[model samples]
Target: MPRVTFPHVAESYRSFKMLMEDLGNEVILPPRPSKHTLDLGVRYAPEFACFPVKILLGTYLETCPKGVELIVTSGGVGPCRAGHYAQLHKKILHSLGYPVDIVVFEPPRLYPLDFLHNIQRLNPRRMSYRAIYECIRRAWRKLQALDNVEKLTHKVRPRETIRGATTRTYRRVLEWIDRAYSLVEIEEAERSALEELQKVPQDPNRDVLRVGIVGEVYVLLEPASNLEIEEALGNLGVEVERSLFLTGWTRDNTWAETTEGLTVKEAAMPYLPELLGGHGRDSIGNTVLYAKRGFDGVIQLAPFTCIPEIVARTILPRVSEEHNIPVLTFFLDEQTGKAGMTTRLEAFVDLMRRKKAARRPA
Candidate 1:
């Protein structure tokens, strides 16, 4: 039984672990991204590689030494450099004498046979078809549950009368979700978690700023990568809504978009018709949607040098101007500091508040 691990990107790891374990594979969880992880990644990864690549590489470097024999990760398509990350990591690790086996899961549209084969390879016990289906169903449910909790926390955080209460409750609930084994247990954890969050005292009269977060999926989802931007905004009495979630991203990439209402592509079509790779198109589209939805402002977060986001950054100003919304873009890397981000967020919130107040009839 080869020890397997994947990058720790937000709470997606819980679902990934559940799937692997249900398939009878040994799972090795990596430590959350820290300064040491960044240092190791920077030491090995190319200087110009995007921030996520470095962080992911750093995570693998930290985990592989724990006798991990197989590394499982997803891949991308189009112009985003993420499509090549698995190969890049494999080469870098092999050169350093790790010699781990890396299995990259590209979109099924691009490599159907390869994707199925890779999944089969992971099942050491060769689980039956029904078992595998059940495993996938359970894992998907877990991912959706985690995402729901995240959305609830965002709403509660901004209105909470007790500072930091929402954040603490969120962390505790995540642990409960992670510990859940069956679908019934997962739902119980999710329901109990939501109830707990709603119990947090909140100010009904609080006039909070509503901000929409858009940018590269990695930066948008990963707390360490984005300096915990969501929590920071929530603490400052701002309600944050992200354009991307793990389940949403997985659906958009893996299957055809069957969402009934306004799709991200339709929203962005007026601004950017073509798919620019990664979440770039989604960022543009989501900003437009947010503007129409009357969000106070939009913040775009991306790893420095990410081509897709760089393209989105260029066009965001036009969207901001035409949509009558204020858009702020932050390019993050190893050099990004928490204090600087917080200061900017505070300023942005203040700006939004003034703008909202000025619109009210006397």
Candidate 2:
């Protein structure tokens, strides 16, 4: 049995791990990213390659020695640099004398053709088509369940009467979900988790500042990659809202692409007014929408040298200036310092607070 491994980009890995287990393939996910992992990625990667490229590259590099016989990776088709990463990583890993076989799946990960092939390729035993399809359905449901629990965390974090209570509860709930044995068990975990989270007691009268986060999908969703910004913002007494989650993004690109006639380009109309891939238009639209919805500020986080977001970065200030909403753009590479990030975030929140105060009628 080949011991296969992949990086945990978010909660998506739990469901993926389950799916592979059901298919009879051995799956070994790399440990959560840390200083060591970041350093591993930066050392071998082309300095200008974006942050996610390093994270995944480093994740594979660090874990390759753990008896991994194969590596499962993903890519996208676009002008954006994302899809090119895995292809390059394969060459780099092979050059380093790691003999592990690397498999690349096109984006959405569960498209009919690629999804089936990925399963068959990784599995040592043959499975019925029904088994393959059913596994995907269950994995997707799990992704939705994870997102629901995460949304609750975002809502409860800022308003929780006790510091860190919501975060602690969220972590325990995640562990509970990971141990669940079935779909019903997962749902039960979610319900029980929500009940536990609600018990944390939020301050109803607390005038918390609200901020919206929008940016490159990986940086926005990967907690370690972003240095856990959501927790930082919540501790700063601000409510956090993110426009993308794993489930929503996969649904839109995989299933919803058939019906999404307007495209992200249309959503960002009159602002960016074009599609540059890597969610450029979506980022622009989210900033405008968040502004109209009374959010005090918007933060755009992305990897350094990310083309799509750099395109958005150029246009976001225009949206900020026009809509009168404060926007902060943070471009992160492995070199980003935590203290500096915290200081900038603190300053942004303070500025938004003063801005909000000025808007009130005397």
Most accurate candidate by lDDT: 1
lDDT of 2 at 242: 87
Candidate 2 on 1-362: residue-level lDDT in tens? 67888877777788888877887778888888888998999999999888998998889988887777788876665678887777788889889988778777875444768766776887676878787777778888787888888987887888988899998888888888788767788789878978888889899888899898989988998899999999999988898888788877532432243344434455579976666778777898877777766789999998999999999999888889998999999998887889999999999999998888888986
What digit string (tens of lDDT, one per residue) describes model 1 on residues 1-362? 76899999888889999899878889999788999999999999999999999999999999999888999999997788899999999999999999898999988788989988998989988888788989999999999999999989999999999899998888888999999989999999999999998999999799989899999989999998898999989998899988888888533531233333566788789888898899999889888778877899999999999999999999999999999999999999999988888889889999999999999886
**lDDT of candidate 2 at residue 145, scale 0 to 100:** 82
- C-alpha TM-score for every candidate: 0.95, 0.92
Ten consecutive residues with minimal summed lDDT in candidate 1?
A: 250-259
Query: Could you give me the TM-score of model 1 versus the true structure?
Result: 0.95
Q: Looking at candidate 1, what is the lDDT of residue 315?
A: 94
Give candidate 1's error at residue 113 in angstroms: 1.5
- List candidate 2 stretches off by more than 4 Å: 108-112, 249-264
Please give the lDDT score for candidate 2: 0.82
